[model samples]
Target chain A: MTNTSQDRILEVKTLWHYYGNTPALRGIDLEARRGEFVTLLGPSGSGKSTLLRILAGLELPTDVNVMTLDGQDVSNIPANRRNVSTVFQHYGLFPHLNVRENVEYGLRARKVPAADRRERALKMLEQVQLSDFAERPIARLSGGQKQRVAIARSLVLEPVILLLDEPLGALDEKLRIDMQVELLELQRRLEMTFIYVTHSQEEALTMSDRILLMNDGDIVQTGTPEDMFDRPNSRFSASFMGVENLFDAKVVAVSDAGLTVEVNGASIEGVWTGASLPSVGETICCGFRSERVQIADDSTTSMNSLEGKLTSHIYKGKYLDLTYQTALGPIRMRSWQSHAAPTETARIAWHKDQTILCPKS
Target chain B: MFRPPTHVAPASYMSFVLIWGLVALLPTAGLLLWSTLTMENFQIVWEPSLQAYRDVLSSGRWQVTIRTLEIAAIVTLIEILLAVPFALWLAKGTKSAGVRTVSLALLTIPFFLSLSSRTIVWRGVLGLNGPINAALLQLGIIQEPLDWLLFSQFSVILGLIGPYFPTMVFPLYLAFMLIDDEVLAASKDLGASPAFTFWNVIVPLGLPGLGAGIVFTFVPMIGDPVVPELLGGGNVVVLSASVQSLLRILNYTVASALSVLMLVILVAMISLVAAITARFAKGGL
Candidate 1:
């Protein structure tokens, strides 16, 4: 995917916001570039939505200075003066207007001339592929149709930026997937700057050019999806992504090759390449995803192998989920169901790089 | 519903409907018949004539109808114009609940207060030597107490506005609140100014409330007697007072005829306005 230009379309410098005496956002210095699809991926209460509201000018920041839209100072500008459009999950279509009227609403407001408004609205409705239903009352529309009309309404305005707050949260799984594909296509075609917010990790990975993973009102990491998945920087990211097994281990030795760690009275060796690597006797947390652990066959296994009793086995579509009681406590592993039958004793092993270590609190 | 076999019948439902219809229509029919009968001996009253209708359509009685329409139209126009700005302020103002509650109190306190008491209070405030006149004098803004403030068309209008302004405001406020925040954002993002947003998005969205407010405030004002009787003195005679005079004198025929005329005019006004509003609304009434 093409990245947005480094020249910022909007910038915030040390922005702060509060509701009454409670702070919702504190010293948030964020920027959005032109034509970028940046997803603010966070759990709720992480200030992602609040940040979007501030950017849209719906809520005033308590203390901040900011520039927006080609370096124009928009710190004190009201919502109506800012060049940003927002689409909410509710799809907020005016019930009293027809689809065409709703689409033309912004154009008429800007005094784009009556003749031109009609033409532009028609063109926009066609873009969303709702041209046949332009004259239908909004109340008569289905949920997806209403969403399409709302998108058309926002798009017809030709805003500098579009902020979508969980736009597909209300849709069913099938419809949500369809809308996500359509939205990505529209974003590419229009070259509009998009700031999408969602708590769904799948949506963040699929739609964002860059994901800003937020937690507790702070961005934990901002990087590509591959970087986030293959090399998570924090325990929170690792756990949130999919790591199912974690254990506190003590580093016994480190060399240019690898490090040996002790966990649950068992010595395990792992690659130690992180910048925050610990010294001898320092405590660290080791993690591995459920899918990465596998049953070790003594006939073919070479390194980092363990012998254990099979506690339970679950037959998943493509793999068998096996729980084993190992010297390092209970560890979960996934093996192809076709290759393995449930045996009381099973040997398990994984590569050293598959085991990740983080500084233990 | 599909027709059943001869075992079940429809007599019971039809009988119930007939009974309810008779119960509703009987009083209106009785009133119409009795009003048309000329009074003689109690049981022998008969021979209806055009005399009652003539009296109602006479110059002396017709002026009250005209006067009532004039006052209602003026009040409706003023209320709608004033309420639009106030509604916009309420909808787009500070989101602080305390501020909103206080502003709403300003509208509802008088709205719920006794209409008579509010009129009496205004009567005192707008008196020749009342608080308003005294303040103007004390501020050296005027040397004379303004006679236009009391016992004139203005005071009557003021009294009507004081009691009925919230009717205009609450609906318009609701309409404005119903507008989506995204619509306003979209307008701004497209380079719309504040004034343009108000004219195009805010006004069109709130038009239903405006139309309803005008009908609710103006329609009742036409038949209301309290404001004119207290503040208007003999300056204005609305249709309700005319109906009252005929009723008091036992001229039920003329009273009924005058009511019918007013009802017809009110219905026409409502229909005309509704048609116009429905045309522009695009999707709904």
Candidate 2:
């Protein structure tokens, strides 16, 4: 919740990384406050995991202007000397060590006394609810238990920041949800900074206090979950965030309220969500969520109404997805209510407040 | 549709085990039985006796047995020390595929040659007039050709090392290759230094292969008749040489007794290695 620089625990500036000749991270700047759960959400081949590795000191960046952890410069420190831990995607626990020894490894490296190390390791294992499994071999553990042991191993080190690279990506759906809640609870309880990298947007939206959406080696947008879902600033962000309807439109009139754009010879009203206002006669993209559309019976007075024929209906258990072929395109709507049969002519209307207009690129 | 046989018949299984036991265990049992009988007047005595065992101690053949064990143990230790780091580098250090392939091919090439032929090349390299002495003389490190470099314990041990090095390396290479890079990265990320990671993670995970390498190198070095014969220059007599001389004199009972002693020592050494490795790596390997 604290977003100011005074409470910043980790800060990175101008970080660049290249794998051979291909640039993976391009001059990215990142800042996280104390106890902030910041999620880097991106698809595969995005620079999210690379950025996390550099922050954890497991990787050396091609160039970095400055990096600090807890106000201490950590740009040159290696992973072992740095006070940061990482939970690998496959839960890379040592196969030779038992559960307790695996957790005690970091303490042993730091030369903690035997009695104190055992006590601390057992206490951390108890926190992860794996105290009974202290003597168990790593091969005997299930997937979820291995995940918990991986977490316990990192947490026992008491690092400044914990970097998780798709830690729950290996779990099944039910267990994944369970671990998501458990992870959030653990982070809140310990008040530790967690930098999680995941490609699942729903997981990011559900867990993060701030989300940095990355694409093509750059973070295109950074905002809260609601802001990201409601008002995406680019065409990529809108499509990545599950906005179903998008149209290419040219602005005809600009007013204080919003802009009126001409879409397929029909004048549509939408609010501008970009940083700068677009002048009249400028081309841009407009998008809206499928759930925001409604079947309007009296469409003659509405400002953003489209007349179309219902082409298909998909039953999705919790909701129905209705596709309508209008002059603009095939517009899809997610409706919770049962609608008219297919081939019925209907008018769909969306409020201007629910509309989002951004740059075409 | 054709389906493979799921289970073999019980009679066939028993017969298969019987055939293996006959081909393997019967000869060892015969040697043990023969060691207990003594020769009388150039003919075999039916009476069993411990005279051959007593003669082994009195004739000082036991010293040769101990010397064989000592040299084998030293050479095995040296091989382990050299092979581990080389195997580790080959498995995880270099990123070049060509280097790995070339090194593996080199290690495997010696396997195709006979041990005598492979070891003969080292004599040419370590002899007084060999390239090693030539190089040392040319570099001004030695005034004369070093006689100790050939036909000594050093030369015998050196010859044994080259022939058995691949045996030590191949198993270790396999074990180190199977170690996940992520596990090593996790170790570093968990605040362990490089040295700590090598001792705690790399060594324990590589124990099975280390055990196999030790057995493969040590067992054969004890009974090898070529290296000590060719390089020891008739001064270093081992158990195999004593057994050969005893057989030439028709001392079959004492020869069998010495062979049984060697077998006992080998079993004990292998078992000790297995116990230590098993203790260090529980539920692993």
DockQ of structure 2: 0.60
Docking class of 2: medium
Top-TM-score structure, candidate number: 2
lDDT of 1 by residue, B124-178 (tens): 8899979999999999999999988988888888888877788899888888888
lDDT of each: 0.79, 0.90
Clash pairs for candidate 2 = none
In candidate 1 the C-alpha lDDT for residue B194 amounts to 75
The parts of candidate 1 lying over 4 Å away from their true place are A1-14, A29-35, A57-84, A157-160, A190-192, A257-260, A269-275, A280-283, A299-345, A359-361, B1-50, B87-94, B97-113, B138-144, B283-285
Q: List all candidate RMSDs to the true structure.
A: 4.8, 3.0
What's the TM-score of chain B for every model shown? 0.81, 0.91
TM-score per candidate for chain A alone: 0.89, 0.96
Per-candidate DockQ versus the true complex? 0.37, 0.60
Model 2 spans with C-alpha error above 4 angstroms: A1-3, A263-267, A279-283, A300-303, A338-344, B1-12, B138-140, B283-285
